[model samples]
Target chain A: MVNPRLMVWLKGLAAAAVLTVALGGTPSFAQSGEETAHATDAVEHEAGVHDEKGLPQLNTKTFASQIFWLAITFGTLYVLVAKVGLPRVGAVLDAREAKISGDLDKATQLKAETDAIVAAYEKAVAEARAGAHKLLNETAVTADAAAAKRIADVVAGLAVKQKEAEARIEGQKQTALANVRAVAAEAAAAAVAKLAGVEPDQAGVDGAVDAALKERA
Target chain B: MATDPLHQFRIEQIVPLHLAGHDVSFTNSSVYMVVAAVLITALLTVGTASRALVPGRLQSVAELLYEFVSGMVRDNAGAEARPYFPLVFSVFAFVLFGNMIGMIPGTFTFTSHIIVTFALAATVFVFVTVLALIRHGMHFFSFFFPSGAPIVLAPILIPIEIISYLMRPVSLSIRLFANMMAGHTMLKVFAGFTITMIGALGAVGWLAGAVPVAINVALVGFEIMVAFLQAYVFTILTCLYIRDAIELH
Candidate 1:
């Protein structure tokens, strides 16, 4: 990220360097070079000869004071940091860490609880579906048994009715046959008497009718 | 006023006092050191005043600085340096704050001075030396000679090791002081060009002056980065030194 800025700065410095060289060369290019040289010499002289003591950093006079103040300030800063500042910052950081961990723990516990609830809910739904399936199967079986029993009862009633009707028809048919036999006997006796102009015996006529009926059976 | 690049490094006595025959007068350097200390203290103290679980902006910055130095100590110095965390933290905060504060125009850069950086480095060197001596007793001297090397190579390697060991504070101090002084001096020189150009050339000087200004602008950005880098270098070196003392490596 800073590379581009550095590049721009380098570019600017290069441009500036070129410009400085061009401008610096101007003094020699013009006739006023001697005057500028004198001014430059004057500036250098004053700068070098100002105190003649060299750099102030080399000055031994201020060393004691600087050291004295440094000891005091640095010592005080160390004490303040070690005793007051660091401990408090450390405490805040520790507290924040503890709070974050606590929140995370709580979240984990809640998630576990949610997972358990989901598991229980799923189990209940499964059990209910199984129960419904069992109940549906049981009802279907019971309904089937009831319908089978009803159909069996209806078939038995119809069979009994058919047997009774057949018995009644057989009885009527026997009664009608008896009546015909009796009428046939009476008519034969009457017809024999009328044709011979003499009385015919009932027993012989009955005997003849019986013999015919036996042959037909 | 003379546009001397070195002019900015000059220390002026803010309050003059003679202490027991010593010229221990409070100066601008002292003032800035005190400011740096106070600022570090305030950033740590006031920023964490709320002790909020969720930090505010100032608290976040304070925490970031705290963790940055803490991680530096932990990574470089190891767990044995845990007890000395405050010392490492203080040095880091002091140097970092001093360098950053110096980036402001016309501000006194205390870290740019040899005496100040030398004093800081010397403190670290002394502390590490004492710690090693106390922990290892006479065995601390074994640091000068590798155990696997032949006795014939001891003469060659021992002196070299000793010189390098002794140069620790010097190198440490000079690296920070030189970096800061050089960067600030370079910026000042470039800034001086603007004034010099205007002085040498009349109305047309403004257009030409833009060149040095542009250079100074870019240099200022670079110097800010250097300031951060130097502080990190100084603190990490201190941590490394501490690690060496503790581990005897």
Candidate 2:
């Protein structure tokens, strides 16, 4: 660890460096001194312009004041908000929520009621249709029965008229037949009387006519 | 003066007051905080005043905010988390309003402050811890070493779990604070650069400054997105924390 020659050489080098610095450092030092003066002057001027030194935030003296005011203001705010602001907003929101759900419930109820009404209307219409059908059937049956009775009465009257006409025709035919017999009997008696010159017995001729008519019957 | 990017975060006292030897002065941050509260309260109250069956614009926004947080609680923390809805809602509205209101120019961002974010995170941490203790009793300690994990690994895992659990507030606070502060700072820096460039180099600077302006224009949209995203992340994380406290998983 102890190198004597190297130590001597290091000591000489240090002496030479010191000599060099001593000789060379004077002008630089003088120059740096002027620069330092200028720097100080600038710093002084800058300091003069600024009212406060350093960061205002770092100023510990103002901490109490800031903290104090913060507490007061923050405290006041908390009170106002907790007591007034939040409740009001909460109330409004709750009210709006209640209103919405209530409206929805009402809407649902109305729809149900409407559905019931529509159902009732449909049922009434169905009953009316059934009643109308029944009425129509009853009217048709009554009209059909009346028409049938009228037709039957007309046919019965026509049958009676036909019977009476047939009886009259039969009576007329019998009368004509009686008249023909009478006329034939008269003519025969006259012919006999004219041919025989003497008056044939009228009673006898009448008796003969009667016997011949009886034979023909 | 306005060129300083950090200038925006500076708290200016609107009403100087001292109480218990502590400077309790009402500042610009407080004003915006109050304004956010008023706006949130007004939106919820006035918007729901009509109780219209069909909501209008304001009512829609109010209802959306309500449902969004409620759904978040239900989905993330489960039905058991229902009781905490108001607290969760308040936190969400406060943060969302803080972020969105900050996006407006010349407005102070309260969420950008570490103190405010830390307070919120600490409150959540305490709440969850207390809830766990109340609900689960001494069994809450079981959370440090996950069940089914090898008990032999308890030396390694328990510390890790504990550290991570304790780090919840730190991570939560830092994340929100850092994001808001960083995004706003970057916006301011770019805006200041644009002004400085235009002031220093005239026509050439105008052309050069347009680059930063364009970037800043894009950044404004990006910052707005970040604002909403960070708010969501914050609230969702809170919901998750509530879930953890309730379930101890």
Candidate 3:
């Protein structure tokens, strides 16, 4: 929006300038012979009057000059304030605002980047967790299979050893029984020969023993 | 009444010197102006020197003054106008102090005079105008002849705009000057009545004097309000002026 105030000031300055130019620039320009005469008469008429403060009455001689200077003073002041002072202030304000906005933008961009990074990191972590779970499952299955196979191999080996042990025991027992029977027979025959005179009837005895043994068997 | 108060308000030659082919007389008013300037500087310096986190009364007052002006500028001129804070703040402080100081029994109120107020107002005006011209170039003139005005009414509207625009300094100066002068004058008149009445019949004069004294006290309070109000008005106008110069619509 146009500053109504600034416009007003500019308009004042413009008017003052226009007036000055139109009135012929400065008091000297306006002070023609006729105007001076009229001024002198006006001043003489008002001379001896005094106010409550004992001050002399007004004079019209320097009226134009007063107006001129008033304009000049106002114009000069206006220029100084408008041209020099205000702009400096404005620049400071603009700079501060720009700085704040720039900071905000930087903050926003950083936040966005951080969020993206966090999301990607989270995704990677999830993938890693999933892979780890899959590996653990595969390891568990492989371990179970190896354990079962080992157990079966051990059971088969024990069965084979039991069979061999039983066969050995049976063979040894047969051998031992044969030996014992031979020894007993040898001893009994010897005793009979020595103690008794039964050796002459060997053929008859053998045939009888054979017939008895066959009947007992 | 004098066509202008300048003639009536002359500072007689307390000390006279001629310089640069002009008669220069250092008068009481001139001395006071110098004094006022120095006072402002000293007050600001002393008030702000400590720059305390928790302020003393003097510093608090100074800081309040600063905030008040800056706040006005921000509100009226927009956030973008923050850079102008110091200028606005200083102007407010100077004018405020000048007005208040003038109220003291023996102090001169520079703001009470038209020259000082006009000078201040004119400066604001010129500043804004130049800003507009620089920012908008020839288009700045369009401010006087607003766009979309019906062609038939342009003549009347243009003159009115011009007159209103020209009155900126006059209105600005008059507002401050008139308020200060009128208020002070009323106080003086009342004070005179109070004194004069006191010399009359004992009880009745005493009672009459009491009325004017009470009124004077009330006027004093009112004048204080006017002092701050004028400062606010001036600063806001400055912001508005800046906005016009910058935005032009």
Candidate 4:
């Protein structure tokens, strides 16, 4: 569609230019010089009339001149825009995009590094906690063993003292009983001798004493 | 007829000035150009500054102008020329407004003059050529020679190509100038006829005058279309030229 429009425009321009040239130019020399001059004068007169009416009279020379100047103006403007303005705008946009991308990359790298550091720190802390807990448990078990050993030693020492005390009490009781029996027997013999008054036979006295002693035992 | 339309083209001082022993006449053309410049500035600034999501009428018009030219450049020259949007847009607006504004009762259509149109055309021509040169370097000269042509045809084909290429600015400038001048002139002639006919005949003259008046009305509509079309054509050609420069085919 755009191509067609351009073609149409170019066609129109060509036709208009051709018309202007044909109208402006001198007629062919095949015609007499007089006819040529008359044709030229007629064209000039027509041009004058056109000028008075403020119409563009077809003139190739003027047309060519106009084209020359138009080209100059358009060329200058194009250079200014294409070379100067466009490059500046492109550069600014590029710089902005680069800045944004660079910042994003930096942020990503920093975040990764930070995460790694945090992981390392957390691992160290967990290891230290585990070590401390293990040490506490071992100390508690050792302390319990030591306390039990001390209590066992105290009970054994008490048992040995109790056994020695029992043996001493039994020996004292036995010696006291023996001494009391000796005293009673001597008293009995003296009493028996005083009551009897007569000199009895030694055998009878001995047999009676043996009988009394046997009965008392 | 004015001795010189170029002479008529002057930048007049709004304030009187005595500069280097010259008596300068402050003309209507200068005042209008200034007014046009100011008008363009105010319009674009005010229209775009609001930057509304749902554009107001004025802003929409501004946006439409921007989109239209940008679209043209994109479509005609391809996306690579997107960077040239502003330049293309500026040319469109300036020429479009300049042509339309001249249609007002008493305004000078600078575009009607050959010099102004030629200036615009020549600028496009030079830029396109320069672009081709810059992009292709010495190989840019190949553009004047047709591809896949026999060596025997070079003599005929090369001259034709060269002439056609050289004629671009001429065609571009004249197309605009001739259209605008002819359209305006026709309108003026018809308007003059309508008035003169009405004055000559009493009641009947009004009936006769209606012919030219109706024609003039139709011409007005046509001229409006032409004004816009001419501006569009000018910009589109510029884009094509730029495309050729960049692509060098």
Candidate 5:
């Protein structure tokens, strides 16, 4: 990441260098020298890290104050840490530790509770399935019994109707046999009259027809 | 214009004063020291006020400081040195902040001073020594002589042992002071090269001048790492000294 930024910066610098060269103006050393002199004095006046006194660190003149202030500052900081800072930080750490362990305990408990609920639900579903299966089997058995009874009823009714129709057909056949006997009598009487050239008696025809029909039976 | 790299280390009296024949003038060093202390205080004070479980950046920093110093103390000095964690931690913070603050172009570095570093080191040395004496009484002297060492070698070994023990404070103080001074001086010198080169010439000089600027940039990054490492080194070493005093190494 930094490489890309650095590349862009270098590219910009190169561009700037090219622009400066294109403009191609000479530097003003004389004027800068005067500014440099004043700047150095100002820097010395402010920080004064070097002077005729040598390294200010090694200089004995400022040692007392530095030490004095150092002692005061160091003591105050030490007091702040020992009395105030460390205890608060320690408490926060302790609380965090307790909370972490406590949260773990709660998570474990919740997991156990969920596992138990899942098991119970599965058991209830299995029981409900068994009940439905048992109900289906019971319904099937009852419907099978009902269907068998209905079929038996239909068969009984058909047998009765068939018997009634057979009786009615027998009555019609008897009536037809009687009418066929009467027609046979009439036909015999008419044949006798035509063939013998004389009218046949009804009594005689009846007798003849009765004899023939009896012989055929 | 004095283009000396050493010029950057000078201390000037912001307000000159005298008290009991001592030159106790408030200087830039003093100012930077106070600034470091205040910054450290303000950071801990405000950052930790929320005590947020999910930490913000400032709280995270504060917690980082706490855990870092506490772990350092526990690791170096064992569980018993838990009491001295605050002082050790505060000193580390101060030196760490002072070094980094000084890295800025115009700020003073108090840790570069022998007087300042020595003062801090001496306090640790005295505290550890006092603790050792109070705990061990005459037995603290036994530290100079190992149990297995022959009595014949005791004459040479004891003085050497004493000298080395005394040198601990000096070496500790000089290590931090020298590192900060050397690093800052190097930066300043390289910075001078950039300024002089860029100021004295034209377009070609800018290209040439970029060399020092590049070096300064790398140096700045390295110096920041050095600043953090030195503070840790100083702290762990202090804890080690305290451990030695307690355990009689």
Candidate 6:
């Protein structure tokens, strides 16, 4: 804080410097300086009366050359940066931006393609399921029809066998009835001969057998 | 002269050339200006000579500087100042380098000089004024008189505006000059104290000098920051003034 006050005196020194400069004194802009914190200890250490100069920048004499070089140097740097440097940096940034956007576009495109392929695969699976269902239904119907035909063939064959078996039983029954009648006639004739001395005639026996068979039927 | 904190600011003729009754001789201030220019050119041109997409440390520094000034111009001056990008960048670089180079133990700080800072400030002042004149015509004078104000207020406000406008260069030049000059002189005084203490106090006195040396070291770092800040102030102000001239508000 005490040190900062050193510049307080500089306000005057600066004014004096500016005044001297304005009044056409020596090129002594150097008089602009801060007082030491120990101004009391400064002890009048004066280099010369001319030594305590104002701001050197206010000097008229050096202005020409300094400005001259300043223009040339600063101007050249300006041109270089304007023409070359900024453009290069801009290009790098632009290229990076373009690359990023392009990559994003490509990613979107790939995602779209993947979605399309997935859709196609889903459609194929659906069609395959429908085709399998139709096949299952058609096979069931064909199996039913074949089973019905087989059952009909077995019934027809069994009916024919049943008719043949009934006819054979009827024939055997007729033969057995004829044989019993003939044997009965023979026995009756023998009994008559033994007990009453009479053998019956062929026509009589036949008549008797016919009458008996009719009664039984 | 070493004891003289102000001696470093002394201007002495090196080549002593005179032409057309004008003393245009190259001096210490002139040499530093050239040194600033060369270093800036090297920092920019050689630093970015490869122009790598991925920057090295030096190139990053160069690119950072470029973008820093670019951002300042864009922010304060608006996009119309895009064309003036190089000029602003150059001024920022020059002032920055000149100020920083001056911080070296035994070198000259040209920016501390009012002559150099004033010329720069004056040039900016002239350029902006001309720009306002060209773009706004006589309407530029209306800048002194605030718009939407009572006509009675014009008498009060116009002169104030014009005076402030004219004082722009003075303040611009002085702020940088005073800050640099004071800081440098303060450092020199402290350094002189440290040296004097070490010499006068003998073997044990060397330890007593540590305080000043430590403070001087801290001041060096602070001055470096001030160097950068002052350059930024100078450049940004230029941008704002240019923006004002262009927009005429």
Candidate 1, residue A147: the lDDT equals 100
Greater-TM-score candidate between 3 and 5: 5
User: For model 2, what is the error of residue A95's alpha carbon versus the real structure, in angstroms, after optimal superposition?
Assistant: 1.9
- Would candidate 3 be rated incorrect, acceptable, medium or high by CAPRI criteria? incorrect
Off by over 4 Å in 6: A1-59, A108-217
| Tens digits of per-residue lDDT for model 5, B54-86 | 878987888889899999999999898888888
Q: Score the docking of each candidate (DockQ).
A: 0.31, 0.27, 0.04, 0.03, 0.24, 0.22
Better DockQ candidate (1, 5)? 1
Give Cα-based local distance difference scores for all models.
0.84, 0.84, 0.63, 0.66, 0.81, 0.77
Residue A65: error of model 4 in Å? 16
Tell me the lDDT of model 5 at B33: 84
For candidate 5, lDDT tens digit of each residue in A75-125?
888888778877887888888889999999999999999999999999999
lDDT of 4: 0.66
Please tell me how candidate 2 rates in CAPRI terms: acceptable
lDDT of 6 at A66: 65
Q: Cα lDDT for residue A70, model 1?
A: 88
Checking candidate 5 for backbone clashes, the offending pairs are: A48-B10, A49-B9, A49-B10, A50-B10
The DockQ assigned to candidate 4 is 0.03
Clashing pairs in 6: A29-A54, A29-A55, A29-A56, A30-A53, A31-A53, A31-A54, A32-A54, A57-B113, A57-B114, A57-B115
Give the C-alpha miss distance for residue A119 in model 2, angstroms. Answer: 0.9
lDDT of 2 by residue, B169-208 (tens): 8777767887898899999999999899989999999999
lDDT of each residue in A1-217, candidate 4, tens digit only: 2236456556866787685675344224323455655545545532122222212333332333333333443344445434543344334445556878998999999999999999999999999999999999999999999989988888888888888888887787667655555554455555666787555555655566666657986
lDDT (10s digit) by residue, model 3, range A94-160:
5556878998999999999999999999999999999999999999999999999999999899899
Enumerate the chain B TM-scores of all models: 0.98, 0.98, 0.87, 0.88, 0.97, 0.97
Candidate structures ordered by lDDT, highest first: 1, 2, 5, 6, 4, 3
Full candidate order by TM-score, most accurate first:
2, 1, 6, 5, 3, 4
Alpha-carbon shift of residue B20 in model 5 (angstroms): 2.3
Candidate 5 lDDT: 0.81
